[model samples]
Target: MRYLLAGPDDYSLKQKLSEIKLSLGDTALLADATTLFEGARVKAAEFKLTVDALPFLTPCRLVIVTGLLSRFQPAGGQVNKASRLEEADTFSAAVRAAPPTTAIILIEPELNRRNPLFAGLADILEVHEFPVLDRSGLKAWIGSRVSLCGGAIAPGAINLLAQYVGADLWALSGEIEKLRLFAGSRPITEADVKTLVGYTGEASIFNLVDAVIECRLKPAVESLEALKAGGLPAGYALSMMSRQLRLIILYLDLKSRGEKEIEIRRRLGLTADFVWRKTAAQAARFSFSRAAVAYRRLLETDLAIKTGRMEESAAVDLLVAELASGAGLETRELS
Candidate 1:
C-alpha cells in the first residue's frame, strides 16, 4: 500500500507512522525489513530499487521517505518547472509501481497540494493531512490523552491545560503524562495544572511579570534563572514576556473603560478561568504606563538580540534587571 502523510502536526504524524510500523508482524523482523530514505538526497532510482527489493526474514517491508513531496514544491517559482515536473513524474511513477507486500510511506512536514508529485498520486495513495487543532479540538485531544494514560481529569483542568499548552501536541502529551503520574488515584484538577503544567514556562513568566510589577529584583532574577534552567531559549522567554505585558496593558485599558469581566475575558481570548483571573489580578497590580515602559524595553532588547548588538543571554539579563529595578519607570508616574 502507498501512503502519503503530510502536515505541520508532527506529533500526530509520528504517531500515525508508529501505528503503521507496529502493524507489520514482529518488531525485530519489521526493523530488518524497514528502509528509510531522505527524500531530498535520495534518487528516484534508488528509492525504486529499495521498494522493489524483497523483504528480509519478514513477510512485508516498510519503505519510508521523508520530505519527498516537499522537495518538488516550486518554492516561489524559483525552481525550473520543467525539471521539477520531470523529477516529480519520476517519483510518482516509482510510487505507482510499488509491490503490494511493501508499504511505501511518504512523509512531509508540509506538502503543497499543487506539487506535481502530490497531484499525480493523490487519487491512488492513502493521504493523511494533520493540521494543527483549534481550541475545541485541542480540549478533546487532551481528554483523550488523559484517558489513554489510564487517568481521569476534571473539565476545568482540561480547559486550563488547553489554554496553557495551546496546540502543541508534543508538549500536551508530555504534560498529560506528568499530570497523570502526579495525580495518581485522583482525577487531575485545575490546581494541579496551575502548579505543574505552566511551571516549565508560562507559570514562571507570570511569576517574573509579578516580580517586575512589584519591582522585586530578587524574585525576578530567580524567575529568570528558573526559565533558563528549564531549557527555554532566551528569545522565546523574551517573546513570552512581551506577550504577557501586552495582555496586561490591554486588560487595564479595557477595564478602565468599564468593561465587565466576562466581556473582557472574551475580548482577550482567555477562556480558562484560571488564566483570566490571574491576568485580571496582574492587570490590576500593573498600571498601563508601567506595562508600556516594560513593553518598550522588551522591544529594544529583541532588536538588540536580533541585530547582533548583544548576545541573547546578556540582553535578556539586562532587560530583566532594567524592568525589575524600575530604571526607566522611575521617570513616569505609576498611574
Candidate 2:
C-alpha cells in the first residue's frame, strides 16, 4: 500500500499513522519491521533499498518517509527544475514498484499541487489532506472527541471549547481528555469549561492587559507571574500581549471610522461574544496612542531577548513594568 499523508493538522496525521502501524499486527513485531526516514535529505537509493527490503521476522513492513515530497516543491529552491524532474520521476517509479507487502507512507506538512512527485503518484497514492478545521468543523470535532473519550458535553460547552481552543487539535484533544476526566459521570458544561480551561491562556492575558493599561503595577506583575507559572514561554506571552494591543488599536480605529460593532467583530474574526466584549472594553480604556507605544515596547523587548542582550524572563518583566508605568503616554495625545 502506497499512501500520501499531507497537511498541517499534525495530530490527525499522527493518529492516522498510528492506525496504520497497529493494523500490521503485533506492536513488538511491527517495531522490527518499521523504518522511518525523517527528512528530504534521504537519498533515493537508500529509500528504495529500505522499502524493497523484506520484513525481518514479520509478515509486512512499514516505510515512513517525511518531507520527501517537499524537496521537489518549486518554491523551496533546493533543487533545480531539471534535477527535480529527474529525481521526482525516480521516486515516482520507486513508489509504483514498492512491494505489495510493504506499506510506504509519505508525509509532508504541506505539498504543492504542482509538485512533479505528488502529481506523478496522485492516481496510485491513497492521498489524505488534513487541513485546519473551520468553526463548525471545530465544534463538531470537539463533540466527537468528547464522545470518543467516553464523556458527553453540553452544547454550550462544545461551543465554548471550540472558541477557547480554535483549530489546534493537539490542544483540543488534551483539553478534551482533561475535561472528560474531570467531568466524571455528568456531561461537561460551559461552567466546567470556564473553570477548567480558563479560556486556555487568554484569561491571564486579559488580566495582564488590564493591569498594564490601568497602570496597576502589582496586578501586572502577578499576572505575569501566573503566566510563567502556567508554563507559557516568555516569548509567547509577549506575542500574545502584542496581539491583544493590536486588537485594541484595531477596535479603536474601526470605531473612529464609524463602523458598526458587528462589522468590526466580523472583520477582526472575533467570534466569541465574551472575547468581543472584553476587547471592546479594553479598547475603551486604552487609547490608540497608548496601545501603539505598548506595542512598540513589546517589539523592542522581543528584539532584546532574541539578541541575547537581556534574559527572556527579565526582559518580559521589564516590559510589563514599563508598559504598566505608562512611560511613553505623555508624548502622544491620549485620544
Candidate 3:
C-alpha cells in the first residue's frame, strides 16, 4: 500500500490523489486517519513515527510526504550535508519497515533515481510519473475528458483549447468543465471556445507583448485588463513579459546567424512548435531597441512593486499605460 507519484503535471497527480481519497469513502474518517508531512520542513523522526502509528477507526492509515527526494539531492554547497544524508537513510529504512496497514504516498515534482529512497524501495513502491504532454497528447486528453463528462467537441475546438491552454492540465481541466456547461448539449465549436475561453493568461500575455511592440495602445491596455480580471498576479505577469522579451532577443540573435526554425528550436530547448513559431514571429515584429526598452521597463516596474512603492495592480496599470503611450499620446485617448 505504498505509492510514489512524481511529475511536473500537478493536475494529473492531484487527480490520482483524489481517486485515493474517494476510495477511502467517509470524509470524516479520512480527516482522522491521514497524516501529511512536508518533506523539506518536517523532521525525519516525526515522519517515521507517524508511519508506525495505527489507523484510527479505519482499516488503513494514509501517510503522504512531498519533496523528500529532491531535498536529499542537493544542488550546491552542502550546509547540512551529513544531516540530509542521515534523513535520507532514515526515510529509506523507515518506509521499508512501514506497517502493512499503512498507505504511504510519496510525491515529488522531480525524483532522483539515485536517491536512497528509490534505491531501497524501488521494488516495493507503486510509482506513477506524469510528464508534460505534447500537442497531440493534450488534444487526446481533452477529447477523452469531454467524452467522460458526456459532452462532445468539434475537432477544431479541441485544437483551439489545447493551443490556448498550453500544457497546464489543471487549467485545462477547469476549462473543459466550463466549456461543457456552456455548450449545453451542442457539440463544442471553435467559436464557442473562442467566446468562452477568450485568452488564458499565458495566451493573452503574448497579445499584451505584441500590442506593446506594435504600439497598439488599445489592444495592449485591453490585454492587460483581461489578464488582471483573470486573477493573474502582477509579479507573475511581469516575469512572463520579461521572459518573452528575452526570448525575442534570443530569437533575433539566432535568426541573424541564419539559424532556421529547427536549429532555433533545438538551441532554445523549445519543444512546442507553436511556441517557437509565435516567438519567432513576435521577435520579428519588434526591433531590438524596442525589445530592450521593454525589458528595462519591466525590471523597473518589478522593483517598484517589490519595494512597496506601488501596489501590484496599480503597477501593472502604469506599465500598460506607459507601453501604450510610447507614441506620445495617452493610451486612454487611443482608438
Cand. 1 Cα-lDDT: 0.81
Distance from true location, Cα of 239 in model 1, Å: 6.3
TM-score of candidate 1 on Cα atoms, chains taken together: 0.62
Tens digits of per-residue lDDT for model 2, 61-126: 988887777667633334457867998898888888888889999998676777788888999888
In order, candidate lDDTs are: 0.81, 0.81, 0.77
- Where is model 1 poorest over a 10-residue stretch in terms of lDDT? 71-80
lDDT of 3 by residue, 1-335 (tens): 78899876667888998887777667578778898876767787888899988887887888888767756765431334465666677888999888987888998866667776577688988889876575689899999999999999999999878766656666677789999999999999999889988666767787677678767688678777767777887778888888988998887778656565578878888787556655765764565666667777788899999899999888988887787668442222312
Residue 89 miss distance in model 2 (angstroms): 0.9
Q: 247-313 in candidate 1: lDDT tens per residue?
A: 8989878866656667889999998654665576577556577788788889989999989999999
**Candidate 3 regions off by >4 Å?**
76-83, 200-240, 243-335
Summed backbone clashes in each candidate are 0, 0, 0
In candidate 3, how many clashes are counted?
A: 0
- Scored by lDDT, model 3 comes in at 0.77
Model 1 spans with C-alpha error above 4 angstroms: 77-80, 202-335
**Candidate 2 C-alpha error for residue 126, in Å:** 0.3
